[model samples]
Target: MNAIPPAVQPPVNDEIDLAALFHSLWEQKLLIALVTLLVGLLAAAYAFLATPEYQVQSMLRPAAIKDLDALNRTGVYELTPEQAMQRVGASLESYDSRLAYFRANPGLFEALRQPNRSLEQTFESFNREAFKMLQPDPKKIDSLSAYVGIQLTYPADVNGVTLVNGLVEHAIQAEREKIAADLQTVIQNRLNQLELKMAAARANYEASKDARIAELLEADSLKRAQLQDELKALRQQLKDRRDNRITQLDEAIRIAKALGIGKPTTPSALGEGERVAQGSVIRTEVNNQQIPLYFMGSEALEAERNALLQRRSDDFTEPRIAEIAKELQLLAHNRQVEVLNQRENEDLFLKDLAIWREEATRLRNLSVDVTELKLVSVDQVAVDPLRPVKPKKALILALGVVLGGMLGLFIALLRNGLRRGASRHHSDQSSLSS
Candidate 1:
């Protein structure tokens, strides 16, 4: 009997019963249909009631060469088309610039106001996500040109078109103003430098002029002193010679008076001629040797001495004295130094005066106007969109139906399993009671 009990085998149920599962699902088909209908209604309500969003886009490209020519011609600054475009792009991306624009134009963003949020918070959120800058992918080889685009996604009620276009214009204007201001600053700095240079030149010229005046005055003083000393010496020498001549004449006059000679007489006049041969008359010796003072006659010497004593100035007696007087007169006042000292505007005499004045004048008069200058070429302006991009009704409704059907099928299978388990439990109780 124990050997026979060992031969009993356990049940094997690896395969699923497809038929029973299908029958149970079919029995709960009404419940599945009701759940699917309820879910479908909710999905339809959401698809129809949701607010629609619109996308407005604008395309931008680099400015043309001619558009930036005016700014580049200043010589103080240079900007290319690409650089201008980059500046415009940077302005567009600046949050401060956007806020300024938004504050300046209030009516444009009136529709974006929310009751639960302040204006600043709303604007911050809008600035963060409402605007998008689209550029070509760097990894893509098909990109032919460097193009930028601005896209705005907003509610249908908002003026997306006006907002995008106005933003672009504001960015361009901001960039233009920046360029003009930078150029003006450069020109002003150059003018300041030139002014400083001119001032230095004037100061240097005045200093040099003053130094020249001092030098000329010192030279004139020294020359005048030297001339006065030379004149005094010459006059003294002339006086001494006159006195010596007078002394010699007195001595000669004493000798002549003692001999009783009253007129200029040679040796022959004293009877020497009678002793010489009749045909050989002695001639008066004439050479560089001065004749004796007594031979000049006392009357002639007395006359010359009286004339020398009566003369008021000895300058006329010597040629060198006259020359010295004339030189002293010339050194009395330096005409060049006087002219330099009396000058009111010394800058005019600077060697580089003309060059500095010309350059400074040009800089002061330099003007740059960029009011009409175009910094960017708007390839496409935003237009009112004809359709919305959000609220995909068809796709949402399809997903809702599919999900509802799956949930309903799962509920029906669980209910059928519970009913079968209840029936098995009742049968087991009845068997135990019997």
Candidate 2:
């Protein structure tokens, strides 16, 4: 097919030659060593010159039930150990609390000061990184109890142990004060409420007493009026009886004078024979008629009328009149109303007085010293660390050497590749020129 171009063949160099690559790398060993040495020295300088940081940690656990018993006993508030621990954790995590502690105790963080930064800036930096709250991982199955920790990473020169411990104590003290204040507020509010109730109760009692006084006065007025009316009726009845008696006496006296009889005489006082005769006659004439009042004789009737007319009062004439007079005299005063008005301790008569006084006393006497309260338990206090935690010199040195060797190797390979490409290009150009 035009001599078929004899099946032109392509270059076959798919496999890399290990020996040639080794030789090329060996040729550039001095440059590789120089690069590696420079990187290693830099790593060493950084490792040695960097300041060391120390870590101090404190562990907190829930307080015992007995430790929180005092606060729980005050029925106004209740606090559990876990809640206390949570409060302490929140305080520990507060930036303001940390800043306050730092400002109040400047000497504690003096070593962290720097010439290029203000005290506030330095504290900000320290607050950002130095403090850490450590908690157990929720995913871990081995975590049985709730625990909280405060870890402080500070420079070697700073007293991390004192700083961490002081921070923990300060948080606890702050929580205590807060709890105390809350308790005081609760007790005060209760006292105020009790006072209001007591005042209301007293007012109601006074109102009731006044109402009772009014009721008694009204009843007394009614009773006195009734008694006075009854007394007046009794006196009129007595006068009417006396006046009628006088009229009957005058009629009897006129009958006695007309018949010429002066003294009281019974038919029986006459001779027996004459009395029998008169009785038979009267029996035949009078069936059931009573003897005439004139038979009582005018003298006796006149004497009775005179006695009734001369009487000063009708109180003795009827027993009920005397009783009515006594009752009227008693009603005039209303002893019950007088007693109620004169009562000095009206509250003592109130139904809930004892209960109100007892509650008020209990609230007023409710005093708790938060300083004595054990809000949390420090399972582990921060201790002075024996060694620094930062600037892991050994690991840094090892990494530096490894990275340096790898970078050096990469540079060597790049240079060798460039050289080989340049040589191949030159050969191809020479061939084209020939």
Candidate 3:
């Protein structure tokens, strides 16, 4: 009998067996398509059936003003730009503050608790998502000048835009009040400091006035004493000069008599005798009326005494000295006037300082009851948004198509490998039996 040749195993395909693989896949194309279609349909249905959520968005720009300008506008606080922004940020971040705000305006949060009848459930839902609607953007938190973005996600049924707007306004008002309160505290502290300074200034002004008065009094007394001493010295000097002149006149008259100068009946001789007799009187007439006599020592003595009398005549008399005393009194009066002027000037300065202090105190104590304090400007307020933001149908459908196609291809490849393995096993068994 002819030896049956051992069943020869097929050679391993060096490259992919494209023809056979294509034929196998084509035979199972119905199964693959059915599986892919079922998966795609299921995914599409799920996507369309899911509830859609809408986004309520807004942006708040913190509009800052100068501190003095803010004070001018509000008449209550010296609020800085940075502090204003910080106050808004604090309101946005504070959960308790927001809760309190919502509680105050029940209308704001009441409508948001729809579909849930239980109070606890409503609160849980509000705390979970609704309360977070007015939070500041994390990216722009560090940069105070940048606009703060606000986003709220809610079901399509809710009026998210109107709700967000209300919340934004509420938050802004809360922050403004907070800022005003803080500034009031600051002003109070500053007022306290000003009160102390004003007290010290008043004390200093009082002391200065007292010191000036004392100085003026002392100066007036000293000046009066000096004037008295000057008057006494001038009077004594005039008296001594008067006595010396009289003694010289007496000697001249005796010399004339000793020289046998008899009184002549001429006008020139009579004038000389009269001049000799005039020196003995308290007051002398114009000496120009007298004539000179040339006899023994009488002529020389009369000339010397006349020269002494003329020199001494220019000396201050009682009336002239009294005029000088009046002038000194006038000078003292002028000094006192100057001191009074200085005091007046000091008083004026104190008056102006007091006025300034009073004005500052008025500003410090000024009450500001702001019904509205606008810290932030809404760059873009949320409008009634119609379109839903979540549950993207197109994306879901595309993903479903790709995943279903991959799964169908995997099943097709698996079936082909199983068929090949079974065929190889059956052929080997037939070869063994033969």
lDDT score for candidate 2 against the true structure? 0.84
Angstrom error of the Cα, residue 48, model 1: value is 1.7
TM-scores of the candidates are: 0.74, 0.78, 0.56
In model 1, the number of clashes is: 0
Ranking according to TM-score, highest score first:
2, 1, 3
* RMSD (Å) of each candidate, 1 decimal: 5.2, 5.1, 10.0
Clashing pairs in 1: none
Scored by CA lDDT, what does every candidate get? 0.82, 0.84, 0.68
Superior by lDDT: candidate 2 or candidate 3: 2
**Model number with the top TM-score:** 2
Which wins on TM-score, candidate 1 or candidate 3?
Answer: 1
In candidate 3, how many Å is residue 340 off? 15
Candidate 2 residue runs with Cα over 4 Å from true position: 1-15, 114-119, 227-323, 355-369
Candidate 1 scores a C-alpha RMSD against the true structure in Å of: 5.2
lDDT of 1 by residue, 225-320 (tens): 989999999989877877786677778877767755677776446554335467866566655766567766666666766776676766666898
Candidate 3: list runs displaced more than 4 Å. Answer: 1-9, 62-86, 102-145, 200-356, 364-369
